[model samples]
Target: MRAVFVRPGGGGVEVRDVDVPEIGEGEILVRMRVCGIDGTDLEKAFGRPITPPMLGHEVAGEVVESKTSEFRPGDRVFVHHHVFCGRCYYCLHGSYTMCPLFLKTTIEPCGLAEYFRVPRTNVERGAVLKLPDNVGWEEAAFIEPSACVLRAINRAGFRPGDSVSIVGVGPTGAIFIRLLKSFGASVVAAADLSSFRLEAARRLGADIVVNPLEADFPEECRGATDGRGVDIGVLATPTVKPLQTVLDTIRKGGVLLIFGAPEKGEKAEIDFSKLFLRETNIVTSYSTSEVETNLMLSLIASGRVSLRDLITHRFRLEEAEEAFQTARDAGRSLKVVVEA
Candidate 1:
């Protein structure tokens, strides 16, 4: 089987002939249909928190073989990227993602391969969900990221009539905008340096789009909320500046959600006096779990969220390099998928 893997020492991904993963008891084998190339994949390729073995996590495919009776050959499914240990302290306390074992495990042989193995833990623990007939492989591949957005929005706790401001109109940011609107937010504003992303955000139902480079973003957000500032501000860019902007745009007693993963060791300064006196809150979200992933799958299947509009490009496994390049230059692209 052919697989795209990260070479050691920050080298680019290389196509290699690797053995197909073997299925264990209660495990399932999926014939890869489509894998979403994320910003994390770019970070991994550059050797940030470098880990060997499989890399791709946002995957969807047909069940080629299975040892469990719950699933069988020809069943379409979406694979959950992370697996949690049920006996861990975090799991016992309902903080499954914080479990040490979940962080230690990786999807064997990665998602960017001709075939990959689904762990017994994921299958038995309800990590994998059957894809609906109306959803195609490309749209189903978005389930992972959509689940992440769902988790972030849930943590932010937006009220039905709350004013919302989102910084960064990338794939994740755009998804956040759509979800926020669906939650009945009264005012939805999105900011990004790229006009392409801002346009994409508009298409995703953002009420207002602001180009941070050409406008006073904080002032614009403030004006949009009638000088009270937005009720909630979501920082969806990996840059530290956006975090500060989120803080500035959020009103007193408002919430700030940091949804983007900044580079390691990144730092930003904030006005402690404002945070203290205003009683503002700051929160960050990481990966998604089985529970949230299942919800996102349902939402996608129901047509409440459109994953089709988010996919702007697709590449084959052999075009992995080109796909990475396109993702790196995200100003012109939204979500890029690599098909098997």
Candidate 2:
């Protein structure tokens, strides 16, 4: 089997031949069909790499072997990399993503491999979901990410008909637009440094688009919401430099949701006086849990929302380097997928 590995501290990836993962009792082995590349994957590959390099997680595949009765051979499925222990304090408090076990459980050898093993813990915790017959492979690959978006919405306590301003219009940002529109948002305003992404946001149903580099994003967003600023502001990029700008786009007592993951040691400076006086509420959402993933899968299976159009690039497993570069560049591409 072949798997992709990131070169630490260097913006590069290499494909190496490795033994196919072996399944243990109550475990399962899946043959990769398609996997979606994520911004975090690119960040780890290009920027500072974490202890374990990021490869792929938004994945869909065909089951080749199963040791549990919940699934069987020949089932098309989407596997979540992380699953929480429902008995933990975090889980009991509705913060499932913060469960200690969530970070300990993952698919073996990462999701960018030709084959990977699903651990028994994940299997029993409902981390694997069977794909509907009507769902295509590429669309199935969106399950994990769409689940993430849905979780963010839930964590932000997003209300229908609330005005929104998104700070980044990348792939996840586009998902936010689609989901917000479906939930009956009064208006959706998207902002980005890339004109290409702004246009993509427009096509995805953003009522207003602005380039922070070319114009005043806060002013434009405020104007769009009748000079009261937006009800909620979302920071969808990993970089925290634009965080203040996102805060400025929110009205007093509004929520500022951080949806992207920034590297360790990254810090942002803010005026505590204003943050206190304005009563700006800050919230963040990490990875998704089984609860959100199941809902996202059901939404996809029912054809209520379509995510197939977000896929703008596809690369073979051997073309892992090019795929990483394409996503890192963030030009003329929406979502990039690596197919086995």
Candidate 3:
């Protein structure tokens, strides 16, 4: 079998022949169908590298072998890469993503492979979700990212009809727009430097779209909310450049949700006194556990939301490098997927 691995020292992705992953008791082997290329995957490939170097996680596939009766060889599913131990302190506190076991557990050899093993721990914890017959591989590939957005909304205690502002209208940002509107947000203001993404946001139901380069993002957000500022401000880009800008777009007592994880050592300057005086709250969301993934799956299955249009580019596994390049071009592309 062949798998995509991030080239060491940040060059790009390389496909190499590797032995097929073997399944053991309570484990399952899945043949990859399609996997979404995430911003983190591009970071690992062309920027700084993170541990394990397993590139893809937004994946969907078919079970080729199963050792547990919970799933069969022919099951078509979306497998979550991380699962928490329900007994851990984090899980007990409802911080499932912070469970120590969550980060340590993952799909074997990564999701960007011809085949990968679902560990017993993940299987037992209900990490695999069967796809509805109506869902396609691309739609299934969106489960993880959508789950992540759902967690951020949950953490921020988002209220329906609250005015929202998104600082980065990338693929995930688009998801935020779709979900927020479905939940009855009164208005959504999307900001991005890229006109392409701004247009995409408008098409996805944003009431207002602003190119920060052309207009003041904070002003635009405030203008849309009748000068009260947005009730919720979301930072969806991985860079900290727009952190304070996003923060400035929130109303007093509003919530600023940092949904993007910046590279280590990246810093942003903000007015601590202003935040304190204004009663502004800051919330950070990490990866999702099965709790959010299941909800995301149900939403997709129930036709409450669709991610099909967010997929702007698709490539074969052999064209993984090209896919990475396209993903890097945020001005032109949204979600890029690699088909097996």
Candidate 4:
């Protein structure tokens, strides 16, 4: 099997001929059809908090082998990236991503490989979902990221008719725009430094688009919201300054959802006095859970969110480096996928 893997330290990824992962009892082996390249994959390549063997998580594939009776050898499925210990306190409380064991596990030799193994927890607990016939492999790859955005929107307590401003129009941010609009958000404003991303956001259902480099973004969002500021602000960029801008643009009692993962040790200068004076709520969403992934798949199957619109590029497994470069280069992509 061919796989893309990162070196132990901070180094670039390389394509290598590796052995196909062997499934243990209760495990299932998937022959990957497509793997989505994400921001986290970039972080792992540079030796951010994630350990080595990192490559992909958002995967859509067909089952080539399995030891479990619930799934057969020909089922098309989407793998939930994380594995949680059912006995952990976090898992007991339904906060699976917070489980220490979950944080330690790596999906790599992940979905980027020609074939990957699905853990027993993911298989038996319904984390792995069968893709509908209408959903193509490329679109199915978006389930993971869409699920993360869904979780973030839920955490922000987004209500129908809420005014929302999303800072950053990357793949995840675009998904946020679509989901917010589907949920009845009347006013959706998107801010980004790149004109290409801003345009993509508009096509994805943003009511207004603002280029932060060309205008006062926070002020523009406020103006669009009739001076009350947006009801919710989603910080989808890793930059600390954008996060600050999100906090600044939200209404006094508005919610600020930090959905993007910043580099380690990243910090922002926030006004503590203003936070105290105005009842502002700050929340952050990390990864997605099984429940969210299922719901995202359902939404895709229902045509509420079209994953086809998000895909911008596709590469073979051997072209992993080029795929990463395409994703890294702004104005070039909405999402890049590696097909096996």
lDDT preference between candidates 1 and 2, better one: 2
Which digits, one per residue and each the tens of the lDDT, describe model 1 over residues 171-254?
788788888888799989899989889889888888778887788777888888889889889988866677777888899999
**CA shift at 324, candidate 2, in angstroms?**
0.5
lDDT of each: 0.84, 0.89, 0.89, 0.84
| Global CA lDDT computed for model 4 | 0.84
For candidate 4, report its TM-score. Answer: 0.95
Alpha-carbon error at 268 in model 4, in Å? 1.2
Residues 1-340 of candidate 2: C-alpha lDDT, one tens digit per residue: 8899887456688888999988989999999999999888877787764324648999989999999888889999999989999998989998898899988888889899999999999999999999989989999988999899999988888999899899888889989999999888898989998888998999998998999888898998888888999888999997888899999999999999998888777889987899999999999988899998899888988999789899889999989999888877666888999997
lDDT, candidate 2, residue 313? 92
- Tell me how far candidate 1 lies from the true structure as C-alpha RMSD in angstroms: 1.7
| Backbone clashes in model 3, listed as residue pairs | none
lDDT of 2: 0.89
Instruction: Quote the lDDT for 176 in model 1.
Output: 83
lDDT of 4 by residue, 7-43 (tens): 5565677889988888889989999999998878877
Off by over 4 Å in 1: 50-54
- Indicate the worst ten consecutive residues by lDDT in candidate 2: 45-54
Clashes of each: 2, 0, 0, 0
